[model samples]
Target: MKQKDLIAVFDNDRDLVKAIGTLKENNIPVKDVWTPFPVHDVLKMLGRESRLPYFSVAAGVGAVIVTFAFLYYTAVIDYPIRYGGKPYFAFPSFVVIIFLLTILLTFISTVIVFQVRTGLFPGKEAEVPVTGTTDDKFVISVGSKEGLADEIITEAQVILSANGAVEITEQER
Candidate 1:
């Protein structure tokens, strides 16, 4: 799907929130939001559900389990090295290795999952519709559907301006 639309920029979080509230009050549809650092309660203000933390937790747990299982299988079944008269299944001695491996694998998997989910990594270029939105500003972007988009942009701009936004820019993408 292609996003063809206009985006309205704001200077700060308060202005962004006010703009979003105004849009909601006016029953205007907003397609997306962009911000510099994450603003507290922004998702709730915009009626969005957070998913990244949940996904990251799931990936970390999966990584830990897989790493532990692989190490156990390899040490007890594949290699079965009995060093210094230690038992093949010496669980206590394996704790340190297992914990270390679990952390390592979890970190690696978390990074990989984040990169894949966000479409970022080597040989991948992210499509940023508004670059300034992530620097010192926020953006309210709406896709072109009908004349509704212009109305939304106009109302959003008014709200943002009233809420103390220092600058506003509109661009068709």
Candidate 2:
């Protein structure tokens, strides 16, 4: 299925953010934003939040608990050891390994989650919506669906130009 999109290109992040705000104020839906670098303000304005941090935290905690449990079971129940009058379940010794394993598991889980969520895998090419987006340009795209009114597009273009869009073009995808 082919879709029509109105793209507003900005030379800087400030203009892009400002244009997005204006479009929001006018109730124009912004489909996506492309920038050379991560724009925290733009992500907030778009209400885009990542679950990676949350998943990492959970993974770390789970790793710690599981690591501790496995150590305890092996040392105390599975194989009892009495060396140098030390206790079978030595918590002090477990600390270092537990911390290391937690970091390792958390990192692995975070990477896996990120890759899965982003659809990034081997032999897959990324889709670039507009040119110069990965350079210094910022792009704001508004999607046009079936029965979309031309008046809305015109209004959006007016808003984009007024808010410092360097160029506004229509593209079919």
Candidate 3:
């Protein structure tokens, strides 16, 4: 889908950071940035905190709880069976399944969460201003509303190019 966003592309990381700083100084809110690799400085510039770790922890804990509950309800309440003189509600017997399912479910949930949160999925095209972003280019985008409409986008493009942006473009969502 097309998005109405003003994107400033920079050939180098330094240029991107500089453009971002300029935009911030001018009181422009950045929508997002795209880079070939993780840029720690960009995160600092954007003032965004990492949430993936917490999401991961939550996924793991949820998986363990669900697996344990399912196993206990099934083995201890649904149907009971004795094997090798072991208790029907043997805790040890559920360890392997719990461990394996926890890991598997955690991984699955993490991936699903990431994809859902990031708007990424199979066969969906990403909304980007330009190509080559995943190779060596960096892009800084500002949304086109909230006082940052066409006129603001024009101002942004001028500031970006002057501050070292290589290519600038606007898209409509």
Candidate 4:
């Protein structure tokens, strides 16, 4: 089922935030939000806690474990060498390589995850983006046509307008 994105435009940040609160209170899930600048209260109202940080930590840990296993197997068993009084399993020398690999992998993985989750991947065009959302206006985008009834959309528009949405536009995703 294809989904549609509905954009509700507000003339000011206050109105946008109020509309967001109204939608949430009424159980109309906000799909996305856009503003000229950061608005902590608006995000708080949305209540969507990000899982990106947790994902980064997990990826970092996984990278470290894999790097350790690789280094350990190679240095301690596969090709053991006693050089300059250092034993076959010299933990000190492996630290630099492990640290570098972990950092690199974590960075790469985090970027991939961010792009995938945010729909910012290369070649993917914007779906129902509202121009000037980065300048004079604030926007609250809602709607995913799949199972989103017309009555619900109508209700959402009414709620948004009642709360101060100046304009509402519907577009396909």
Q: Specify the highest-lDDT model's number.
A: 2
Q: What TM-score goes with each of the models?
A: 0.75, 0.93, 0.76, 0.73
Name the better of 1 and 4 by TM-score.
1
Can you give the lDDT of residue 105 in candidate 2?
88
Angstrom error at residue 85, model 1: 3.9
lDDT of 4 by residue, 47-150 (tens): 66678899999999999999999999998889988899999888999999999999999999999999989879778865537778767888888864364677
TM-score of 1: 0.75
Number of colliding residue pairs in model 4: 0
Off by over 4 Å in 2: 1-3, 144-147
| lDDT of model 4, residue 150 | 76
Enumerate residue pairs that collide in model 3.
2-173, 3-172, 3-173, 4-172, 4-173
Candidate 4 lDDT (Cα, 0 to 1): 0.85
Per-residue lDDT of candidate 3, residues 51-124 (tens digit): 87799898889988999999989888888777899997899889999899989998888888889998898999
Off by over 4 Å in 4: 1-6, 11-14, 36-47, 142-159, 169-173
Expressed as tens digits, the lDDT of each residue in 48-87 for candidate 2 is: 9676898999999999999999999988999989887999
lDDT of 4 at 89: 85
